[model samples]
Target: MQPTSELVFAQLKSKNSNTRCFDCDTKESDWCSVSHGIFLCLKCAGKHRGFGVHISFVKSVTMDTWQFKHLQMMKAGGNEELHEFFDFYELGNYAPEDKYRTKAAYYYREMIKTVSEGRVLDREKPSIDEGKIIVEEQKRVMPQKVIEKAAEKDPQNIKALIGDAFEYTKDLGRNIKEKVSDVSIADVENKAKEAFSKIESKVDSWNFKEKFNSVKTKTEGVYNKIAAKAKKAMKKITEEQDFDDSKLVEGEDELMLDPQGKNGKK
Candidate 1:
């Protein structure tokens, strides 16, 4: 019996394979290039489409209707398999200027050529034993700190770390506020002054007088530039208002002096 689309998707998700785009490693890839057998993000998929059907036949995993045969083929030819085949010995070292995009395109072209010429290897389905070995190897090589962090549910996920940091800062602020709820404004000011005094004394004792003066001079320069801009803006506005007021006063005086004016004649 042919494999269903649901079955194929489940298999891919279980392996955590193709969760990221093959080109840029962007997460939550929604598109797949059938010819190259690699998952891609929307932007990368558009690039693949530009290569035409002969090069890469792109499809949306969610939006497009899938054929059983196509699904079976995808299940057999996953992203990891395609990557291993195309990036053998990791020959495509991406330069800073190429930014992986060029390398990705090259791999796609190579993969398409391999598929069309029947040079593609037969990929065996990953077994439970292989999965266990991969996990064991990762645990063996990973640092103690990294493993502990992962155990705390803070793996090397950048987005998650950023979110955690934001939340931590917010909680810290809230805790500080609660702790200082009963403290008077004067007390807080005194505490701040004491802290600055200690910092200044330490800086002086450290013989960092030259560095401190340099920093102070730079800060003063920035302040002066900002003050100058503000003064210029205020002067422009005052001059404009004065000009308008003078014109109004001149018009009033002319009307008062003119005998032909109705109010003046009265």
Candidate 2:
């Protein structure tokens, strides 16, 4: 393949006035060659394949930055130049020479900065009550204070030591509830059951039954509410004429009951 400039040089000098290509125009001569040929003229071609276009003939450090550049160009905030830079930045050749490595490094640095700025790290902290822990993460600030506390008491006074070490029950409850608010109720119930089982192991069998029944009652109430809402939505959809029967039948296992024939009372 002839170099881009050579191809353009030949096209520009070609006798046919038809050689001039226009990107915005559909004229046949507007694009006599492939690639940068979409727009004719030395100046436009220079801007695209030469001039400000960065071509790294070297290949030392990773060229991963170029890959990210392409991705960003494909997803940039409407920056045409940056998109083009990403698209054709590696026009010349790659490997052996270490020239392009510098340019590649520059783009890689930009990518690292962009990625770092967009990420948030997770941190774990001990809760005040000491019975539970809090895991936190966000754009800024430490979560240590919310979880851990310090207290001092003379060894001679056990009551005072317990009092100082124990977090207020109300405060602990509020903090625990808030921490688990994002988890599903089922998850909370599972955790509670596990804890209950742990306690039952140390206690008599009769005590376990009462705790189990209490948990079951709460779970049933939740299940009833969810089932009721789902049934209501299904009823509404069944009443709608536009609902596709074929698609409905495709999910037969999900249906609560067989669809009675088209007639009433099914």
Candidate 3:
């Protein structure tokens, strides 16, 4: 059964759509050579048009009108199918120069002949289990462990590890030197000397002798006043001590002195 236009367009715009030009593999292909059922970039499409309509009928995906037959042809055959059919033995290996217009034209001509003969028009599809077996065989041929061991045994890998370690050590040493240089012994000594000089200057500015003399004079004055008071109190106590209770004059009570001699009153 023929596929719908929607299904055909959906396949074309998919992420896994044929993004590379079939002839050169240049990315962002916007054109498709409808007859050959292959995608092509603008540059490659122009070259295909030069080959003439009978050889390569080119159409733009965005601008061209797609008929039901055109869409059916695209659905039936795509870049992968065409490539597999043309390069069945995988012998048509094109070099860089072969990817240009002239060489691509030759392949397109050969493709036309194959299409006319209808060799790849309705080939049988491979079963899912067959595809799985093919994948498993590829894995068996080149195991992941083998590749890993090969990389580990490489001399370049060892040299790279050693180089990285050396760079790390060099960077660490540079950082340590930078930290050490930030603090200098001479700078510390200069700061200490400046602080000591400030303290000595402050001490020199004070009038210590004048202050001491002033304090001593005040202290002597206070001591004299205290001595005078004590002497007066003692004299009164001795004079009173000679008198008995009968010797006390009338209206006079016995004199009493505080033990501290701070106060003397009758």
- Compared with the true structure, all predictions reach lDDT values of 0.44, 0.28, 0.43
Expressed as tens digits, the lDDT of each residue in 125-216 for candidate 3 is: 33323322211111112123433443354433433332332333223322222222232334433433343343234332133323223323
Model 2: ten consecutive residues of lowest lDDT: 56-65
Q: Give me the runs in candidate 2 sitting further than 4 Å from their true place.
A: 1-204, 238-266
Order of candidate numbers by lDDT, starting with the best? 1, 3, 2
Clashing pairs in model 2?
Answer: 21-30, 58-99, 58-100, 126-147
Query: What pairs collide in candidate 1?
Result: none
Candidate closest to the true structure, highest TM-score: 1
Candidate 1, backbone clash total? 0
Clashes within 3 Å, all models in order: 0, 4, 0
Model 2 CA RMSD to the hidden true structure, in angstroms = 24.5
| Candidate number of the best lDDT | 1
> In candidate 1, what are the lDDT values of residues 6-100, reduced to their tens digit?
67777786656678887777886777777666688766775554443444566777666787645654655676776664354242454312322
**Candidates 2 and 3, the one with greater lDDT:** 3
